[model samples]
Structure formats: structure tokens, C-alpha cells
Target: MKADLKQIQSPIKSEMAEFELRFKDLMKSRVKLLDHIMNYIVRRKGKQMRPMFVFLSAGVCGDINDSTYRGAALIELLHTATLVHDDVVDDANYRRGFFSVNALWKNKIAVLVGDFLLSRGLLLSIDNDDFHLLKIVSNAVKEMAEGELLQIAKARKLDITEEVYYKIIRQKTASLMASCCSVGASSTASSPEIIEKMREFGEKVGMAFQIKDDLFDYGEEEIGKPVGIDIKEKKMTLPLIFALQKADWLEKRKIIHLIRNKSENKKAVNEVISFVKQSGGLEYAKEVMNRFYDEAMTILQDFPDSEYKESLSSLVTYSIQRKK
Candidate 1:
């Protein structure tokens, strides 16, 4: 049976609860308008996956302490800032079924809000003298920006190779998770080697997490996003990239033409999905995702058995196996 998030969070339930209160306090602002917007953002938060990674990794490495909570909050504040900015850049109206910050407040205010959140995160670390944790997360934020720019540059041409895909996802999705684990370990005063190991483990889990997200574009039984959204947006995911690789020149050109020109048409989108499915793209992607999942599990085996270790292991499984 698949373990749900509630069960996986059992080891760190109290820490997570305390982190929530601390996080809310960190987000508080003296400005009334900013305070109101921050509250709105807090109310619409999704599942607290990043913080779980932080707290769990800290527990595995050593004891969870004040620094661990600060580390988790730092990740959340920085990540939320990115999401707010992303909505503005994408001109998206909704995020996770709620109105985006930009949608309600408009672009100008939204941009400032993102900046505010970023500063708050920085100050939170600086005030606590958690420079080590700060360094880990700040590098991740930089990599994330670089990764987004790389994806945008590549998306225009739609010629991303498998290796390029790995690079993009590693920086775009995996880097933040890597920082979360590293920060967790660092907050516990773990040695440099152990921190690096947790970072690698987090990176592998993140890679698997992203591939699983890409698979949902093929219309899995339970999907969080609408099917064919990636194709419509002309984003070349692993399955589509692999399928195109297997096709003859003429067939490849035809699908590319369809995606470039007629993606708005439901029929064209369906054709592309059908092509990927028939070409064994889904199976290949699943195989790759499972490989990363296994690698992450192997890394987890380095740590001793404990509730924290078990929950961390379960969290890795839940990430790739989640229906969403």
C-alpha cells in the first residue's frame, strides 16, 4: 500500500506545526497592505513538502533544533517568492486552484511582493547568523533562475536533447530540494560529507519528481493538470522528446509541425499524445523515473534506521508515486 503524506509526516508532525507558526510570524510585515497580501498568500499554501524534506533530513543527520526550523522557513519564503514572480512572468491567473498573487493584486504590486518575500527570507537567515544554510539556498535560487532562462531559450527551438533535459530539470526542480536537504543537514551541524550526501539524495528525488510531473501531460488516470497542456505550450518533455527521437525524419517533422502550428486544435494535441503513447515514450520515461527513485533509496540506506529515516524514505516514494 502507498503511504499518504499524513503518514509520512508522522515523525515530524510537531516540528511542522511549530514551523508553521514561525513561518507566519516571519512573513508578518508592518505595512498593512503587505501584511494583508502575505496573509492571503499564507491561506492558500499547498502541501508543505519542502519543509518536510528539511525537517526530516535534519532529524536523520542529528537533532532537529531552532536552526532547522529557520532553514525550512528560509526555503519556503524564497520558494514562495519565486512562485509569485513566476505567475507574473507567465501571466497565469491561477496557481494550485487559487488566484495567483498577480491576478488579484496586478503585476506591479505582485513584483514588489515577490521582492518583499525574497528580502524577508534573506533577513531571516542573516538575523539568525545562519550563513551556511543561506549559502546553500541562495545558490539554488541562482541555479533555478538560470534553469528557467535555459528552458525558455530552448523551448523556442524545441530541440532539447536527453542530456539537456536532465540539466534543465536538475537546476529547475532539483536544486531547491537539494538545498532543502543540505540546509537540513547543515542546521544539524552534520559534517560536510553527510550534507553533500543528503543533497545528492534530494536531487535524485527531485529528478524523479519532475519526470512524474511530465508523465501527467500524457493523461494519466489521476492528473493534477489538464492533459496536453505541455504540448499546447510547446514544452518538450521527456516522453515527447524520446518519441521524436524514435520517429523517422518525415514523421518527426510532421509532429513538430503539428505542435508548432496546430497545437491549439484539440485533434492535433490528441495526435501528438497518441504518437508518444504508441512509440513507448511513456514506458521509457517511467523507467528513467524509477531509476532515479531507486538511486535516491540507495542513498537513504547510508543513514541508520530511525523514524526520521523511514519518513524520509516514504517521502521519496510518495513524491514519484503521487497521482498528481
Candidate 2:
């Protein structure tokens, strides 16, 4: 599941280059801890998908200005901050094939670094003086926190409804993506109507991204994490939710028993996995994700044709189809 940056279509490659440099520059502060954290994240190497959107939206709308760099860096900082906090919350050992911040350092350090990054994001956005951008991003942060809490509440509740699962994903994952697109459009002075359309595109694509991620928990061959990570963690994701809905009473009871037992070993988890496969939920979830991806592409078509539009479509395609 490697994403090739060269494959991304570019109408304004020169501007994007400048935007990338500016983003890197913005991330480069003199503080030792902050510098180290930023360097680690940069070396880990994300797709920079949100930053791409920022630059692309600005270019598609018109020119690359200071707002473009501010928006791009702010989104990157927000995303990196979230990743650090998520690693601590998940107690994760690995991320992007490297040790997570929480794995290398203590949780307290990771939390502090995450806080710094998030505060930096807010400050940079405020410096830009776009009250609307600040409001949108602030709301996204709040929603993400609420979503985490909702997932925590639903944990181990085998009866967690698909609607609740969707709500969690919408708040935790889609909201940030929505903010990314909205900020991109707003940074370029795009009309409110245009920003709304872009936000819709990001939200739909983000939902597809999250659903596909859930699907991978069952499909990924490598088992560094548990085979059924979400299940073991007592988190009910879409595939399991769908399986419970469509399963017969007997099968449903078996799932409920396994979930309730809480001490189910490798063999028991494997059996549950087989049950989910037999119930056709995995394929159903994949189909649903594909449908969302297709719909997102349809929305991209509504925007006038451009290389940025093409990359945005390609990004959604890659996100849903990716294995990791």
C-alpha cells in the first residue's frame, strides 16, 4: 500500500513545490522537543494528502499566496498532533513502520508534544486572521474529542448499532477531512457555496476512507497487531455491525457470547472472523465503501476539470482501495 507522489496530477507543480517548502519551514522551530517531534513526523513520511488539498484548492481557485502556506501547514500540524495523541490513546507501538511517539517516549511527553502541535496549529490559523477557518477547525477538534468519547462509551457493547458507528466515524474522521477541504476553499476566498461543496466531497471521501480501514482489520495478512484488532479492543466497527445485523439469531448469539466473554483466545477470535466472513458482511462493507468512493468522484466532477480535480479524485480512489 505505497502511495507514489509522482502519480499525483499537478496543474501548478511550481506552486506546490513552494507550498511544500513553506510547510516545512513553518514546522521548523528552534525548540529542541518540538524540532525533534517534527523531524520524526517528517521522516515517517505521510502522504501529505491534506496539504495537497490545501495547495490544490488554492491553485485551482487562483494563485499561491501566504494563506496557502498557512492553511497547508496548519492542517499538517493538526493531523500530526492528532496522530501523536491517538498513538497514546491506543497505546500503539508502531505507526508508518516506525515507533510511535508514545512507544519511544512516555505518554506524558507524547501528550505534551501533541498539545504543542495543536496549539501551534491554532496560533498559525489565528495569525492568518480567518475567523471562519479558526471556527471550523476548532469545531472539528471538539467533534473529534467527542467522537473518541463516543467510541469509548460504545466499547464492549456488542449491540452497538451501525448508526452509532457511522456517527463516530463522521465526528472523529470525516470532520477533520471536512475541515481540510473547507479551509482549502476558504483560504482561496472561494465562496461559501463552493466551500460547502468541497466540504461535502471531503466528508463522503473520508467516510469511505474510514470504512475501508475497518475492512482492512480483517483482510491484512500481516498480524503484528491482533488479527481482529478492533474486535480484540472491543470496538464495534462497520463490518462487525453489519454482520450482527444480517446474521441469524444463532450466529448473532455466538458473536454476542464471544464479545461478552472478553477472554476469548486466538481460536475463539478466529471463529468469530470466520462467522463474519460467512455472513457476507465483509463483502457488503467493501461494496458500501466503493459506492461512497464513486459518489465522491461524482462530486469531484461537479468542480470544473483541472489537474487538481484529477488528483483529488485519484486520492479518494487510492484511499478507499488502499490495503493499509
Candidate 3:
């Protein structure tokens, strides 16, 4: 049975709080201006999913160790670092419905703050002397950067395939999640078999998370993000990839032309959504999400019953049904 997100709060809650406090404390040493921007980014907040995964997986495997808390904090720091750089790359003025650090503090400051966060995370990782954990997180950081670069380099290419889209999502989203789970299991020096299982669970859940988030772009106003951002940015997500497969030559040509011109404004976005609907892209995407969520839960069944396991399972289910 699928778990409820409501029941999955305990392990993640404390760890998330710890990460927030550490982030604040680490940034306190910055100069006034840099400190202000760092504070703003912190205040915007997030679901803290990466840290939550770290905490919950550790709990599910056994008990919370000091490494667990520090690892969780490190993941959040790494995540924040990426968001800061991402704002610069996307030229995004807003995120989480607030002004981005790049918008308020300028790109250079934002980039520097991001670097500081990364450095802080690395410093903290060294305190634990866990080179293995560092390696896992470092790989995530590298993959995320490469993923962003891959997307930018391939932006607006009509020839972009579903395989390519999945590749990017795995790097940009799944890799960190895999690392988070691996670190959790590693804290216990768990068996390689157990570690691999946890990694698979996280990767599948992370992919589901991104795909569900992408669907928000086309959802009704009451249900999701403002539609058209991806189209405007020329980022081809799963829906678009599915639509490409199903659309006829004429329709495909039209979409390819619009993507090439980067002409998908609000109205064009609406038309694309409609076209995707008619082409059954949304259905295909939803089907894929459900399948992945199911697979993630299947992996969790290997673990004996526990509240942490229940919560992790619930998180997977929630990823599909989340409105925002």
C-alpha cells in the first residue's frame, strides 16, 4: 500500500531544522551585503527533500548518527549552492515565488555566495572525515553542473530525444537523490547490496519528483506553476517529448518551428498545452510517473516495516500528487 505524506514527518523534520540552522550559522560570517542576500535565499526556503531523504533513509536503516545530521546539512547546502548558480544561468528573477538572489544581489554576488555555500559544505564534510560521503556528494555536484550545461548546450534543438531528456533529469535531479540515500546507508557502513537498493529507490523517486514538477507547468492555475516557462526557455520536458512522438508530421513541424524560434509565449504555451493534450502527452507522462513511483515502493518493500520506511514510501506517492 502507498504511504501517506502526513505520516512521514518525524525523521525528516528534525534533520531539516538542523540543516537550516547550520546554513544560517555558516553564512553569518559574510559581509553585510553578502549576508543579506544569503539570508534572502534562506528565507525563500524549500521542501528540503534532499536532506529529508538523508535523514529518513538513515533512520529506516537504523538510528540517526552525527554523520546523518551533518550529511543532511551538507546536501541542503549543496542544493542551495546549485539554485544560486541556476538563477544566474536561467536569468530567473523569481523562484519559490520570490525574487532570486541573482535578481536582488546581482550575478557576481550570487555566484560568490553559492561558492561559499559549497565551500562550507565541503568543510563540514571534512569534519566527519568521511571521504566516502564526500565522494558521493561531490559526484552529485559535478553531475548537476554537467546536466545544466548539457541542457543549455542543447537548448531549442528540435532533435532532442526522450533518451536525452531522461539523461538530463537523471543528472540534474536523480543523482543527488541517489547520493543522499547512498550516504544514509554508508553512515552505517551498510552492505553494498543494501546501499545499491537505497540508491535505486532514491533515483526513481527523484525522477518521479522532476517529472511531476514539470507537469505543473501545464496544470490549471489552482494546481501548478504558471504555464509556459519551459516553452519560453526552450527546455523540452517529458510532455513535449511525448507529444513529439505522437504528433503528426505537420504538427511536429509546427512545434519544431516554434521551438526553433523560441516563440512559445503565454498564448503559444496554451496552444502547446492543448496540442499536448490532444496528442496524449500528459497521459503518457502520468503513466510513466506512476510506474516509477510503483517501482520505488517496490524497492522499499525489501526493508522491514518501520515508520521511516513508511514515510519514504509516502514521499514517493506524494511526489505524484503534489499540486506545487
Candidate 4:
């Protein structure tokens, strides 16, 4: 469960350093206010996992190129934009342990910053005629929006079935990862066959990744995300959904009532957490998550072995094993 994340980057260190410069250059603006906001974004960036996915996928299938850097930048740009707007929507004050764009600049400026970042990503692709990469990322953006909307629509009811849960996670979480892999392959001028295969690989890994995140809600782990925050938000994640499936008719009713009305109550959230653990929800979710991880490994195993493949395989393991 312990990966030297620095070792994970060793294979692509030079490319990553180059990408840092590209990412910063891509975020620059002439407007003073926007420049200030973008500067803050540069200062408080996360682990850059999406870019790693892009580079690793490229290394596996073909050579890394300028387009690969741009592909990674596009994912980061879109992801940062989404976080900015999501903070506005959630009325959140922090992101990745730093003050959010909304917290510093307020909702209006935060929203506009999100818009600007999004447009910059799109224009970068269109201007370069990187149409194939653009198509992949654009579709992901569409799916992510629909996924959030679907989750919001379902939140009031707490009615996410296993099928619906898969749909939500696939769009909300998996789409971007899938696009990262596809864009990586496309950057190297990979064949359509190879690109499609990488997309599937990324999607499955992303699904498992989200499930592991949901499992954290029932644990004592202190991730950046608060324990039970999903439940508090009325988001029906896999662990809870699976737990409810195992409940008897009356137990199910009690759980639903608590989720709908007592979600804000810490004691009630703990009760729900205890219920989920005792009902075997966590075990069931881990099982499904491993299945996805193994499937992704199988696809990767078919590829030739190299430093790149080893690093990518390690990433698949780290996704499920990460503490936060």
C-alpha cells in the first residue's frame, strides 16, 4: 500500500517537468485580475494524476510528443475549471486543503474563472487542429455535467440503484480518466484500435477508483474529504447503496428515513456508517473495485513489458490504495 509517489514519477520526470512549464504557460492571462487568480491556481495545484495517466498511457502505446503535453494540460484545465465551479455550486470554502477560488474571489468571479479556463482548454485544442483529442475531452465534459445533474436529481430521493450508481460514477468520475487515456493514445497517433482499448482500460480503473473513495466514507481514515460527507450531501454512493440492498424491509426504511432527515446529525451519520459496515457494504464494494482493477490489469498485461507499463500498473494499484 506504500508507493513512493516520487518513484512513480521517475519514469516520466523530465516530461513532467516540461509539462509543468506548459501547464503554467497555458494558464497565463494578460488581464490583471485573471492573472492573479491563475497564479493562485498554479500555487495550489493537486498531484497532477490526470497528466500522469496521459503520459503513462502514451509511453505504453507510443512515443510522448508535444500533443501529449497538450492533452495533459487539457485534462488539468477542464478539471480545475470544474473544481472552481463545483465550489460555487456546493458553497464550499476550501479545495485540496487550500482556499477555493470561490472562497477568495466570491461566486461570480469564481464562476467566470471556471468559464475562462474551460474556454482556454477548448481553444488550445481547436487552434492546434487536435480535433481527435478535442472530441474525446469534449465528450467527457458532457458526460461529467450530465453525471452531476443526475446525482443532484437523485439526491433528494436517495434512490440510487446499483445500475444508477454505476452510471453516475462512470460519467462523473470515469469519463475524464477515460479521456486522459484516449487523449494519450491519440497524441502519439495511435491506431483507433489501441486508443479505444486504452479508453476502456482507463474507464474501468476510474470506476474502481471512485468505489475506493466511497469506501473511505465508512472508515476512520482522515482524507481531505470529511468522513460521511457523501451521506451528508445526500449522495447515494456504492457502499451505502450496497448496504441498503442487504437490509431487511424494516431496516431499509429506518436507514432511508435517517438519510433523508438526519443526515446533518453527526450521530445519525455515524449510525448509518455503523449500519453500512455491519451489513457488509464495505466488503462488497471492495470486491467490485478489485474486479475492475483486475480487468484493467489484464488489458495492460497484454501490452509489452517496460518501465512505462510497470509504472502504469503501479498507478492502477495506487488508485485503490491511496489514503486520500
The 10-residue segment with the lowest total lDDT in model 1: 217-226
Error of 2 at 84 (Å): 1.0
Model 3 regions lying over 4 Å from their true place: 1-6, 11-19, 262-264
Task: Report the lDDT tens digits of candidate 1 across residue range 1-324.
Answer: 689999999999989999999999988999999999999999999999999999999999999999999999999999999999999999999999999999999999999999999999999999989999999999999999999999889988989999999999999999999999999999999999999999999999999999999999998856578999999988889999999999999999999999989989999999999999999999999999999999999999999999999999988988887887
Query: Order the candidates by TM-score, highest first — what do you get?
Result: 1, 4, 3, 2
Better of 3 and 4 by lDDT: 4
Full-model lDDT, candidate 1: 0.95
lDDT of 2: 0.78
Evaluate all candidate structures by whole-model CA lDDT and list the values in order.
0.95, 0.78, 0.81, 0.91
Per-residue C-alpha lDDT of model 3 across residues 164-249, encoded as one tens digit per residue: 98899999899988899988887777788887889898899889888888887777437577777777778888988999888889
Candidates 2 and 4 compared by TM-score, better number: 4
The numbered model that scores best in TM-score is: 1
How high is each candidate's TM-score? 0.99, 0.91, 0.93, 0.98
Per-residue lDDT value at 47 in model 2 = 67
Q: Relative to the unseen true structure, what is the C-alpha lDDT of residue 221 in candidate 4, on a scale of 0 to 100? A: 68
Regions more than 4 Å wrong, model 2 = 1-4, 220-226, 262-264
